[model samples]
Target: MKLTIYFDGQFYAGLVEIETSDCYYAYRHLFGKEPKNEEVLYFVNHELLGLIENKSGSATRSSEVKQRPINPKRLQRLAAKESQKTSLSTKAELALKQSYEEKKKKKQMNKREFMEQQKTHKRQLKIMKRKAKHKGR
Candidate 1:
């Protein structure tokens, strides 16, 4: 797992990436203001896992073969290179977009079902009113 925190025009945000055997998961969290080290540490320690479990809906699959552990110096260099990049990873962006689309589709389906239910309820009420009118005549 890796967390990248950066200032995003208006607010500070963190992008978390978790890579498993064949799947990759990404989650974004908005911190609003620049977070202090302690705050970031607290979030990682206390809230990160729960948030991942609850909100992580989509995972992207990668076909890359696993490699042996890297040398310490090479790992340090790679970390430095990553720190220089200010934007989120493309894979993370795609995963987030997919999750958003899934949520939107689910919401639309729920709304349609609710509207159908309301229509049926109104029709039932109308039939009852008509029956009462016929009885009065």
Candidate 2:
């Protein structure tokens, strides 16, 4: 698991990446202002897991194989390189897009079902009114 926090024009955001077995999952969280260390720590300690389970659905398959343990000096250099880069990862971006599309599809389906129910309700009311008219009420 890795978490990258960066300023995203309008607000500060954190992108979390998790890899398990062969599947990759990513989640984004927005902080309206720059978050303090304490706040970030609290979120990670308390809410992170629940958010992951609730919001994560689709997983992107990664093709790269895991590497063997690196030399201490080489690992330090790699960490420095990573710190200098602030852009979000492409895999994370793709995961976010897929999640958005899934939500949109669900919203449209619910709207269609609601409209169908309303139509049936109106038809039932009309039938009752016609029956009352015929009985001279």
Candidate 3:
């Protein structure tokens, strides 16, 4: 597979071979180092960029590939796909946010409970010390 990556508005076209660990990392290696986040969306073919923004999949290059006018029907389909992705991402973000808040709240509650127990133990120890002193009298 080949992809064109955008780095700060500049385009670099290269081949992306698959690996066992990570697909993105395989492509990043071609850049001589790890690629930055912004470079992930670069398209190997400039024309595909327009189609992809409205759609989720990549355009495959074939030997018989011909240059022709883009179909309006395809564009419509792509737009629909984009809308679906937006909704999915929004839901995922909300779920993650709620999970983080719950974790934080639980941690705070545990800490408060621990501190209260410590205070109670200290008070009990103080009372025991006073009783011993009174017994000596």
- C-alpha lDDT of all candidate models, in order: 0.88, 0.86, 0.58
Q: Which is superior by lDDT, 2 or 3?
A: 2
| lDDT, residue 131, candidate 1 | 98
For model 3, the local distance difference test gives 0.58
Candidate 3 off by > 4 Å: 1-89
Residue lDDT tens for model 3, 36-90 = 5545444334534444345334333443344588799998999999888843335
> Candidate 1, residues 1-137: lDDT per residue as tens digits?
99999888889999998888788788998888889999899899998989888956457776654558999999999999999987655688978988999999999999999999999999999999999999996
Error of 3 at 134 (Å): 1.5
Task: Report model 3's TM-score to 2 decimal places.
Answer: 0.34
Give the 10-residue window scoring lowest on summed lDDT in candidate 1: 57-66
Q: Can you list the residue pairs that collide in candidate 3? A: 4-42, 4-44, 54-78
Writing each residue's lDDT as its tens digit, candidate 2 over 20-52 gives: 888778888887798999989987998789978
Global CA lDDT of candidate 1, please?
0.88
TM-scores of the candidates are 0.46, 0.46, 0.34
lDDT score, candidate 2, position 102: 100
